[model samples]
Target: MKHARPLPAYMVTRYHGWKATTHAENKGWYRRLADEGQRPRAMIISCCDSRVHVTSIFGADQGEFFIHRNIANLVPPFQPDGSQHGTSAAVEYAVTALKVSHLVVLGHSSCGGVAGCYDMCSGNAPELEETGSFVGRWMDILRPGYDMLPEGDDEARTRALEKVSVTVSLNNLMTFPFVQKAVEEGTLSLHGLWNDIGEGTLEGYDPDVDAFVAI
Candidate 1:
């Protein structure tokens, strides 16, 4: 019946280290943030992959960005069926509540979620095709992207889908009525990005050019 346990040794040690240094140095700023509440200007939808460090990549300061992470950094189309949807809830809060000026969907290279989706669409990942598979169902958001993928080897196809995931999310974001209204009123903007983890390269989707240009 117990739902919690003591912190791991490594985590405890790291917490102490941070408390002694980072927390100590930012004690005043932390207090101010707590008292005033967060007013971040942007919302970032990113992958759950550990390698994709959203704040570090942008050199962002604490409380500067509102971030939500999920499989493949996907945004599902608006569905008001009254079921629980964590990703959708985050988007709703960020756009309608937080009123973030910019919303970004950030994907990355070598994403396991994207790879799984690729294989699933290709009929290579039978396990993921099961109806009870949460991952398979979640990845259905990227199914359209898979269908649009250009012909290529597995390596190239996987990489391309990574970016396609971002585009798909960006498109889906617009499906939300609030998001569409905010964008139409010129109060919000949508962006798609793909991060090349190993190469340390960042690309932003350019609708004008229909490509991801290095940024």
Candidate 2:
């Protein structure tokens, strides 16, 4: 079966408009960065959710943020195995190479990947067999959190699990040797953020208070 051409006229027109605007807005920054290289102050690890766009949310322009995105905005424990570690690679580059002072793990409400973890933990649904390849492996990172949650109603349990999962991912960030050393040497700091979609509120992790406070 022949597939239809993906790029339609409307998409092409929109892309052109975006390209023009982006170029005009970021022209100076691009020139300066191209000459001197990017030295972004922070690195943001966020989810690959269309609604939770880091640039748009933070009002960041080009070369402003070193971003690393993946499913559920998860940061996996560092491993030495020579495998494809996209998130880890980005972290290493951002911290060691770019020397970003702050690393923020940005989580949001109504996250599909987090919702998937809720489904897996509850056992209401079987292991996804159709697209059971990468998603299954990716969702495994949330298993420890899932197991830790107490049995209860789906809504309450899922909400609790999602919040706890943010903490879990934050803990996992320290497992990386680079991140650990950076934090120990006071070169880099880690922060966790939870964005409420409905309320347009941002809650940031307070290490001193050991809680997420609205910002």
Predicted structure with the largest TM-score when compared to the true one? 1
Taken over the whole model, the C-alpha lDDT of each candidate is 0.95, 0.83
Deviating ranges (above 4 Å) for candidate 1: none
lDDT by residue (116-152, candidate 1, tens digit) is 9999999999999999999999999999999889998
RMSD of 1: 0.8
**lDDT (tens digit, per residue) of candidate 2 on 1-215:** 47766788999999999879976787887789899988899999888888887987889877889988888888788886999988889988998999999999988888888888778656744663236547767877877888777678877667666666677888988998888999999999888898887787899878798777889
Q: Which runs of model 2 end up more than 4 angstroms from their true locations?
A: 1-6, 129-132, 150-152
What are the root-mean-square deviations of the candidates from the true structure over C-alphas?
0.8, 2.7
TM per model?
0.98, 0.88
Report how far off residue 118 is in candidate 2 (Å): 1.2
Clashes of each: 0, 0
lDDT (C-alpha) at residue 167 in model 1: 92
